[model samples]
Each structure stands twice: as C-alpha cells, then as structure tokens.
Target: MTAPASSRLGIYCMLGGMFLISINDMLIKSLSGGYSLHQLVLMRSLVGVFFTLFMLKMEGGFAVLRTGRPGLHLLRALLIVFANTSLYAAIVSMPLATATALYFASPLFVTLLSIPVLGERVGPRRFAAVGIGFAGVLTMMAPQLAGKGDIGWVMILPVMAAAGYACMAVLTRKLGATSRASALAIHLQVAFVIVSLGVWAVAGDGRFAEGTDNESVRFLLRAWVWPETGDLAAIAGLGVMSAVVGYLMTQAYRLSRASTVAPFEYVLLLYSLFWGWSIFGEWPEPTVFIGAAVIIAAGVYVFMREDRVKATRRT
Candidate 1:
C-alpha cells in the first residue's frame, strides 16, 4: 500500500518538474533577443545557486551538503553545464521552436546510449522507435540543408545539449540515488561556477573594466540594452521560475524511477511549440511537426514496450 502511494506521489512530482522545466524554456526564449546567452547563463546560474541552497537548508540543513559521491556529482555538474551551454547557444542562433524540436532528440540518444553504457536491452520495437526518431530529426532538418538563409545547423547545438542532459540523467539514475538532492544541487553549482568562470575567462577579454577601450566587450558582455523595467521583472521572474522548476523536478525524481519519469519529457516539446508560436510568431514547418510526431510516437512506443518487457520478466 505504501509503495503504491509513494509511486503515485513520485509520478506527480515528475510531471510537476517537467512543467516547471517547460516554463523555464519559455522564460529563456522570452529574454533571448535582449540578453546574450552568456550573460543569461551567468545570471541564471548565479541566481539559481541561491534558491537551491535555500531549499537544501530547508530539507536538512548543513548535513544535506555532505556527499560521499563527489565524483558522481562532479560528472553530473559537468554534463549539466555542457547541456546548458549548448542549449543556450542554440537558443541564440536558431528559432526557439526548431531548436527545441531538435533538442527532443536527446531521449533518442539516451535510448541508444543506454545499450552501450547501461547494458539495457533494446528490443526490435524500441530499435525501430529510435530509428524513426532520428528520421524525424532528419526530416525537420532537411530544409536547412539546402542553405537557403536558414542557419538551421545551429539546431545541432540543442541536440548536443540534450545528449549532455541525457548523460546527466544516466548519471543521476546510476549514482545519485544515494546522494541527497541538496548535496547534488550544491555540487551542480560548484561545477557551474567552474564552467561559467572558465567561459568568462576565455570569453571575457576584460569587459569588466568598463571604459572606451572595452566598449565593444561590454556590449558583448551585456545581454541586451538597458532592459525596461518590465524586462527587469521578466528576468527576475525567470530566476524565480528556475528555482521553482528545479525544486519540483528534484522532488519528482525522488518519488519515481528514472525510466518511468523519462517518457513524459516528450511533453516539453509540445509546450515549446506552443510558446514559440505564441511568443515568437514562428510556426514550425509542416515537416517539423510530422518529424516531431514521429519522434514522440516512437518514444511512447519505446516506453510501453520497455514496461511490457519488464513486466514479463517479473512474471
């Protein structure tokens, strides 16, 4: 009885987390035109650390910060940084909707990677789904291949980002179970600090000096023109949303198994499409939608098949 109840709670958390993550994607797109991706990443990471820490304190105080699995935390953090950086780069370079559609390919990558890394069995039906998902990616990307003023190659950024995210997922499932969420969150920030600082140093060029010689650097460093008061509110809103989404997402995984939670991530692409159309006035091409549909269907089939297989094994 307790097991069933806990499982139900976990599923709820996972859905909540996905919803928050979708919202975060929307906020990032909302601010894209005004802010450089670099500045946005830095701001979000810096602000996010505060909220994560606060949640950690609430959960278990200082003890939550302790982790026996430093190496696993380090790997997860690095993977997260890579994913964030790549996704941000994609956001800056391509249409949000398109990039997100491509990013959805991450699950497919995860499916494939699991065979090699986790030794998970992939049946024929699941293999077909993986193939179809990649086909959808190709279908969506075909137009860009013609080089008709479409810099769609930038879509690959999100795909790579997704792969990094998938790696994080893999690590989380394999090693993070024993680690407290607070400890994991803290290590994530420490990793972010390292990555962000490294990016700032290599990309910085003394823009911090703020003088005539550094005017160009400042412009690059500054995400956008002095945002209006409303924009400021929006940026801060994104910060708050990040915290909320991250917390909910963390909670969701705590309640559920990774395989169970993984499939719902597909729903995020739908949200991305809705936001992209509403906010950016950009409707994806017909093929993009078709491709997305194929990918999503494939993912669903894979999930169902895997569950069936697991059930059979148990029986």
Candidate 2:
C-alpha cells in the first residue's frame, strides 16, 4: 500500500479500537461493584480467545499464529497485561475520568519511544503537538483532577499503565514484521488466562479481600461467584469487544509509526464525551470542548506533517 493510504488505515484502526474500548470500560466498571477482577479477567479472556480464533480463521488461518520471536511475544504480553490490569485497577479505585486522563499519557510515551526504539524521526513540531494534545487532555479532565488531591499514590497506577502500554505498542511495531496481528493478540489472551488462573489459585477464596474497605483492593482480591445471566451477557460483550479491539490496536501500530498513530488516540476523549452524555447523562462543561478543540488541532497537524514528510521522501 502507499504510505498515505497505510497511514490513514492505521489511524482508522486506532480510532475504532479506542471507541470500542471506551464502551467496554464503561460496561466493566458497571460490573466491578459485584465481581472480582480475576474472575472478570478469566471470563473475558476465555470468551476473547474464542472470538479471536474466528479472526484467526478469517485472517490467513491458525498457522499464522506461529512465531519465531517467542521472547519478544512473551515480553509484549507481560507489558500489555500490566497495562490493562493496572488501568482497570485504577479505574475501580478512582474516578473513571481521572484514570482515563492519566492513561492518555501513553501517547506521549509512544512518541518518545518511537525515537529510540523504532528509530523514527519525530520532528520538533510533532513532539510539540503531542505535548499540546496531552495538555488538552488535562484541560478536559480538570474538574476530575481537582478532587484527586487526596488520591495519594493511587494515581501512579494509571501512569504506570500508560508506560507499560506504550512499551507494548512499540514492541508491537517491532513484532509486526514477523507476526500476524492475531498472533500478537492471542498470545496476550493466553497470558491473561494464565495470570488470572494463577491469581485464582492463590486467592480466589476472598481471604485477602475480607477486611478491605478499599474498593480497588476488594475488587482485585474478591472471591469469584456464580455470575448472573445479565452480568454474563455484559462480560461476553466485553470479550467480543476485546477480541476486535486487540486486532485493531495491533494492526494500527503495526502499519504506521507509533508517533504517527498515537495522536489520533485523542479522538478517544471525544468518544468518551459523547458516550458520557448519551449513556450516563453527564453533560460536559465548556473546558471539555476547549480541550477537545486543541486535541483535534494537534492531531490534524501531526497527520498532515507526517504525510508531507513521507511524500517528500517518496518524491
């Protein structure tokens, strides 16, 4: 494919994945009050694995899952596992807006890592655009950021998640040359299954969650129970979303430079705004619009700038 076309496709995949993940997160948060984290992970991973097999069939076949770079796959899986777990833990522990805002820092990490890891040239303007976009994210999240003064060290979880996720994306680009997108995704699912089962074996009885009034800790260590039919349906939705999102995210980073695709993630904030108002009835304040505008401008600048640079090289 031509560079411009490939870049656009990658952006579309990133936007689509982010849009679905926003909805999936809302559903998971709704379920977190009753279910343990490990149980949720185990259930979702099983369902996700099933769905991913279908994707595997459609996208070449099961043979595509084989990889010579097992070590990189193992590291990538560990990073993504840390990223998702830490982000989810932070979501249950703090305000969703706060956790999300903190996690958006991943784009900045991606831009920075693209330089040293991928050897991509991130120009000064592109770097500034990323910073401006992040500033916009903070602006949109200002209201939620205020009350978190007492959140203490719990706030670091999302940042850690961001770093882990950024590293994973960089690795995705590195592995994309040798592995299919489904391979990148299913390996992570297998890792999730193993980790969740290990946790269940050690503490699924709720002994650790017993006396914890802390929401995040209790959610993490809570004992598994027989899920209600409604909750099962909701988690099943998460699994489906997870499988599609996994492929979309992998394809996105695989096809474009991390720096090129990362800025488009700002659109996720807009998705959150729309979903928040429509589903949850939370009307966004003016700062949110202001921030959204800034984010959009920055993302557009990055897109045009990258396309121009690629064109110049081609010419």
Model 1 alpha-carbon miss at residue 10, Å: 5.4
Error of 1 at 225 (Å): 7.8
Candidate 1 Cα lDDT to native: 0.71
- Among these predictions, the greatest TM-score belongs to 1
Model 2: residue 16 alpha-carbon error in angstroms: 4.5
lDDT of each: 0.71, 0.80
Off by over 4 Å in 2: 1-16, 130-148, 247-264, 274-304
TM-scores, all candidates, are 0.82, 0.80
Counting only residues 3 or more apart in sequence or on different chains, how many pairs clash (N, Cα, C under 3 Å) in candidate 1?
Answer: 2
> Weakest 10 consecutive residues, lDDT, candidate 2?
144-153
Tens-place lDDT digits, model 2, residues 66-162: 8788888999998988998888887766555556656766756777888898998989998998889778767755565577344555667877898
Residue-wise lDDT of candidate 1 within 1-315, one digit each (tens)?
A: 255666677777767766667667777766765565555666676777888888778778878667777777787888988897778666645556677778888777777878876888988888888899889888887787766546646656777887899898777767755776677776776677667667566655434534533222333354233456776666666667767776777666667765666677677777777777787776767777888888778777777787788888899
Predicted candidate 1: what Cα RMSD to the true structure? 4.7
Worst 10 residues of 1 by lDDT: 211-220
Question: What TM-score does model 2 achieve against the real structure?
Answer: 0.80
